[model samples]
Target: MTGDNAVNIGSPQPPQKADVLARVCAALSAGDADTAKAIIDTDYPMVIGTKAQRRYTLTETLRTFYRDGFLDRYSGTQLIHPGALRTLSMLLPKEFPAHLNGKMTETHFAQWELFPTIDHVDPVARGGADDASNWVTTSMLRNSAKAHWTLSELGWTLHPPGDARHWDGLSSWFTGYLTDRPDLASSSGYLRRWLRATRVVQAERA
Candidate 1:
């Protein structure tokens, strides 16, 4: 962290994956459910169907715009399935060990490392407007770390937005996952609604 008037620290580098894991380890070791839940929700957001159905479909389409992949605007880390994050959060504390690992495993990736989140470029608390122009896609970890802080205060630079031509945020993988695990959506209203809405967009794009 630097002073408000500190010289440029260049772009903000994301904390090492090890550091993130260590933090989670500490929280779980202390049996801090609230802290852990905060981490889970911040990192892997669960859909709440806040957007109108048509709006949600449009949002998904923009996400898949040009088949662009997702990247954390602050850390530039690739993100994975939000649905998986929800599942991991549900299975946590009691089932924590099965997911924890020394090496970065698939479970860790989805739960901690690469879960996508939307971030406000300016702090809403500080009068940043709540609109798309003020928003950027980021990982959950970065979002939590940046809560209400300005980019200057954090010594972070805004990375260029992701181009779907190069990275599709593993969307193709998600589509395939849906095909292989249709039952997942059947059980999750969030997933079911997303599937229903995106299907319309997917067809149009096809």
Candidate 2:
């Protein structure tokens, strides 16, 4: 990664996928249980709630909670202060597999080459969270090409086999996932302002 946020590293030859994933796992194991319980659940989704509910891995679910500034979506009266979830996310990072389901980044990665980019189906610029519901894996090439463009704006379609190659599939699936929690769809105006403030700070450094 470069010091400049706006600059994309071309032909960036970085670490191997296994090495990167291992490090990510290490950082996660060190986090709190609320974060770990949701992540370590390899089974993911455990089970999707009525059609109203969408499937997601523990990791993505927690990322969403953190991104949206919450302790847990199912928990009542517990909330993480605004931007705290993002703060924690910045400190303790995770990735979304190419597949929205836990299968995206499974134990066997040798089969799926090219490291995964766990990106938000929705952009944080527009109030997207880190939740699995809003996240997906894609080629770094596709991600760089996508830069800030919404799924529909890209005019891509999802195939029935559920291939991750289609960058647009992530967004389409997320739209359905949000059927259960539309409130999580928009980050608070507070988050938008905070993001802008931080970007200015970053730009000053750049």
TM-score of each: 0.55, 0.25
lDDT of 2 by residue, 37-112 (tens): 5443432323322221334543343333334332211111123222333333333445312232326333223112
Clashing pairs in 2: 38-58, 60-132, 64-131
lDDT of 1 by residue, 1-206 (tens): 57887666697765665666667678999999688667655654443322211222345534543232577778767665454444444446345322434234424434555666666687666666666667677776788899778898799998776766466555555556666877765777766565565455456566
Each model's lDDT comes to 0.60, 0.40
Q: In model 1, where is the ten-residue run with the lowest total lDDT? A: 47-56
Give each model's clash number.
5, 3
Model 2 residue runs over 4 Å out of place are 1-113, 159-206
RMSD in Å for candidate 2, one decimal? 22.7
- Supply candidate 2's per-residue lDDT for 83: 36
lDDT of 1: 0.60
TM-score top scorer:
1
